[model samples]
Target: MTSEVSRRDFLKASAAGAGFVLTFRIAGGATSAAEAAGAWEPNTVFTIDPSGIITVHITKAEMGQGVGTALAQIVAEELEADWRDIRIDYPTSDPKYGLMLTGGSWSVNWTFDALSRAGAGARHLLIEAAAKHMNEPASECIAEGNRVRHLPSGKFLTYGDIVSKGLITATLSDEELKKIQLKKPAEYKVIGKWIQRLDVPEKTNGRAKFGIDRFLPGMVYAKVIYPPTRTGSKVVSVDDSEARKVKGYISTVREGDIVAVVAENYLAAVAAQGKMRVTWDKGPHANVTTDSITQDYWNKAKNDTSAPSWVDVGDADGALAKSMKTHEAAFWTDYVGHAPLEPMNCVARYQDGTFDFFSGSQFQTRAMGDLSKLFGVKPEQIRVHQQYLGGGFGRRLEPDVMLEAGLIAKAVGKPVKLIRSREDDIARDFYRSCTLQVLKGGIDSSGAVIAWKNTLVCAYPGERYGGLDKQGRDQFSLNGSDHYYDIPNQFVRAIRAETGMEVGYVRAVAPNYTFFAVETFVD
Candidate 1:
């Protein structure tokens, strides 16, 4: 069966307003990495009807990440249940589940314990209920292959028949709960064993529906109008009269101040949008060039001193002055964007005041909450179907695509599939933020770095961390120092650029720029 989470429902769950509580609990005894779903909670997985199917709601988004299958293994391994009879689905946009996303290689490692425990708890309840139905002592019953079998009579009951309304009606006492034994690593039949991906066959054969391929019953395709600049600029005037004259074009709507939504066939939409003449406010950034941006970084790094302390080994200042020699250098890196092959696309529909989104994303929960706030709806009302992403590398996780799709759909009253062309994607994209850095260091006679400091001495500043106050905001460093080797006394500092474009995540985040400064400068 397909997933039930709609786009609007997902957005709501993400924000976590209303009475929606996404509780998580760990089971009694299971060894796995911590799940992203906060503290673990039992009773996380439940069946809809007994004897129908076993469903586990996992938090991780699957973008060829193998999160769907791995999470099932967590459940089946712990429950010692039948793997063939189970199906895994995405959780609702609940605060508990929505924020629990699968990215940054944090999938199996994150949900291992919480999901296993949820499975183990469900497994135990099924076993106990089956034992009671068979008129046998639970002590004499063994749970295996979704059946709780009585040793003496070989009597058994399937999980479906054992559970009512998918609820664990038979609650184990605290003592009974403590006595519950989870499968050990040695007893594992599902996890820690070689297994094929469940969705790979469908994917390899072209049967899997990617986010770009998703469509609603009656959906119109739309294209975005991207200006050659960043967000927050105002649209002075847009002349869509010429665009409306195109053959396949239906209409052009000003979805956002700087965005125009054009609905038509692929070639027709491009032909139509190309004809539009738009004028902007030509804000302050209009005159700013990339060269000027890098220049700002140089000045900031030269004066930065407020770098946060990541680690401290010894007296870094004193050793640097006494060192046999000191060295310093400057470095620069050009900005880059993720530019995934599939680009960005979303299928959105709003009916009965609820939003439904079908897109590929790393943050299913975050999507719901962000949308709820954007649309002024309850989080639970948004349903998100996190389709298989073509490629993320962290790009599709942004709110821009999902929000725009929803707005276009809401405007048209028909489900709309919005996408970006290769050119449009790049022009409206965010990059790794170009940087210029200067490093200064001192090495002792023994050839060890004693004191090291690097500043964002370039045209632009680094991440504008919300935690820092206004005075502390502009001064930025991609990251603090990481002196891997032993240094008797060493420290690094951050200096912010006085001006430039906003800085954001690129690939490995701040570490890339920071590492270059420390490693290259220390020598």
Candidate 2:
């Protein structure tokens, strides 16, 4: 769906800054304005204060990817602002931003054009404001060095000088913004030039705050006791008598299969959690293991015909049958965990039908919706304060930790900071799916690659979030199997195996394994 920032929401004077604010409400994938519009107070992409310091507010998660630096460069280049005057800031989750996420290598691809437009739009207004103050025609003025200079007179006004003189704020329509001229590649001064990363000094100097660095006043620590399997588990009983003997043990909370121990401090919580005795009815997946899941993938690849062909051209079976040189092999990839350095953690406070979440998240829009559904409140009632992530690697995209913190806080009637131990983090991870791929190829007598056939099987991760098409194929699982080579006879198919476990999108997701199989088979 396409959406543009409304004039009222796009540009205005910030109540606090007393300067112009510019915002761009660009399209973010399938999300539309109607589906995910949240409170838009001071919703802006960047702000130019009376001092002319440009603060760029980024919506994407910063998981050591340097995305903030890259995005700021895009804006600085188009705005013709001095690099020294630009600042980077990460804003909290707001639906007005639309589909706040940071994955799929989409940070730059999705925001480049829109951010450039935003920068150019602001530049146009600043130039006009400067020309008005200088009593010069806008056409003869050029923006450079964070100032507007009149060519003939050589008289210039700094952006700060123009703003301090009470510059008028104006809104640019989507059409007007599109008509503004953007700098050609040859004219780029800030984008390709070397600059110190804005986040480095803080990170290296121990001033940066990751989710794990959060410390809330009057908050307690909590730890969850995990189930043995991925699904179908229920907590039958909890004996916390011994846990109560711990110096600061508060209590035990059970919600469905999740059992958590709370205490005044993190060490006490861990100590008390170990003392408590809990029993779980490990459900249908009690016997499921990696070996069993891998075997199921192999079985499905060998026998399942209900799968749909992702690519089919010519007669691959006949070509392979007639070739004198043929090769066949199978490749397997086991389930892999995210294992981010910080583990999974969140600080959640639920009181009077409102919830506040403090954590790093790759998918804030969806997580807010999930929290709203769980708490039976409007989306506006939830606020997610974005924080730096030690590392995401596609693991923080899931909101399980945030949801768990919310559950514990609501049950305990106080703010809770939930921290998963390294063991629990790996054990309860939404792992990358196990996959098996069988490939066959034939070569002509002249050693020309002639035929190709491939079949892949896995429990579709997309099934967990409706990521599959009508044919029941997840493109995330079968990305590189469709070879780019012009093989006259080729076929590629995907089979869905029922392994009774959930899967998640890992870094590089399917291509990580798909390319490996295809490249090895080719070699």
Candidate 3:
């Protein structure tokens, strides 16, 4: 995972060979002679073939967010490539693609400039190639509709003709890439305009490949009997005699806390799963309930003074004591689940110390690394293929299902497609943290609020999911509490309480709850 190639390393390794194929060096480089040959396929991101087709490798997962379309628009706007000729595909798990994550509403915001620069750089190279063919300056040529046109004489050359004729050979350096001029917002032909979504056609035609739709050549179907609780739950025993009576039942896999029933097909797998009897130790969380969580968070919000202060300004205690009026309020929100349209599913194949996975993952790069450690193999030994997500809603960000599929595939010695039923998905999901907020405010004689204090108590999403900020705090649980008001004295803090329940980033994360409390108090 630490072997990620830097920008300089990528530029140095990339070479434009004859026949118009651009070879990009990834983690292990080219493994075969065909790849090493001048076939000219770009490694992971965007690439132009000799035929002038612009293939864009989208790193973000398309979870009904139009990310694929928005990203393509950004690239096409600067690349000046024909929209009709543009195609979109997902990249494999490789560090060369950068942080292959697609949540927190960051896909377009993070990639806007980088993708634009990449397009502009590619356009610059194409124009440079056309300049040599026309014997004109690169500045005098304009790229339009996949063709470079000399403005003086109106002579044009297609990108394919120039590239195939060996006119484009130079690749941009990191400095040159930085220096490339990007188009202003007013000049964006694709970004601001309404273009049809790339995924719409496939979805309309029923040809889209969701995680559940994944099928491998020798793949079997698997279904698990999950414990009541995610943590501190262990399988005590399993009786599969009844499952063995099923016609298509293949085998039962028991690894750690996971108990899976494998069959020749999905129906048989579900049927066999229904017949299997399993016993489990419910552990400490067996007694935990929703009401108990509510009471625990409320208590922490009122009394937890040891909580870290996320924001503080002046002395709120002195200001509130001297104020003529004071207001106090508390707000709470129950835990919720990201009930995406499609249930969790992953297809995995393990063989010869290598693993291949197919699923809709928001964090494929992280998944590859985690799976490598879980399987005790190198990062390169795992290949994660992306698929269209029916809906992520921040749920697909975790790769628990992918790991389960890999483990089952390894146990059965065959490709296995593990699918979670609706009930299983809902019951086992990493839920949004139930929150409790306490706010205290002070107002002067003029009714101008001079001081504010807020305390939040909730499960730490980062602690549960391992994405803590540099301050060693789960910012996800404290967002939106910091107000923009001109209060002279303000204090904001969060108490990380253990609810004995799993928590993760839902669509808006902590902002949803924090903003609700702040806005309600202001009104």
Q: Output the better candidate (2/3) by lDDT.
A: 3
4-35: candidate 2 lDDT, tens digit per residue: 22223212211122122245433222133321
Question: Which candidate achieves the best lDDT against the true structure?
Answer: 3
Return the clash pairs for model 3, or none.
21-40
Per candidate, the number of residue pairs that clash is 52, 0, 1
Which of the two, 1 or 3, has more lDDT?
A: 3
Per-residue lDDT of 418-523 in model 1, one digit per residue for the tens? 8888887776665666667656678777776677654454323222212343344332233535546666665544444433344445545344766776676654
Sliding window of 10 residues with minimal summed lDDT for model 1: 31-40
Full-model lDDT for every candidate: 0.63, 0.79, 0.80
User: What TM-score fits each model?
Assistant: 0.82, 0.90, 0.91
Q: After superposition, how far is residue 206 of candidate 1 from its true place, in Å?
A: 2.2
Regions of model 2 farther than 4 Å from truth:
1-43, 464-466
* Top-scoring candidate (TM-score): 3
Model 2, position 487, has a per-residue lDDT of 90
Tell how far residue 322 is off in model 3, in angstroms. 1.8
Model 1's TM-score against the true structure: 0.82
Ranking by lDDT: 3, 2, 1
Model 2, C-alpha of 41: deviation from truth (Å) = 11
Off by over 4 Å in 1: 1-52, 96-98, 164-168, 172-183, 305-315, 456-480, 497-503, 506-510, 516-523
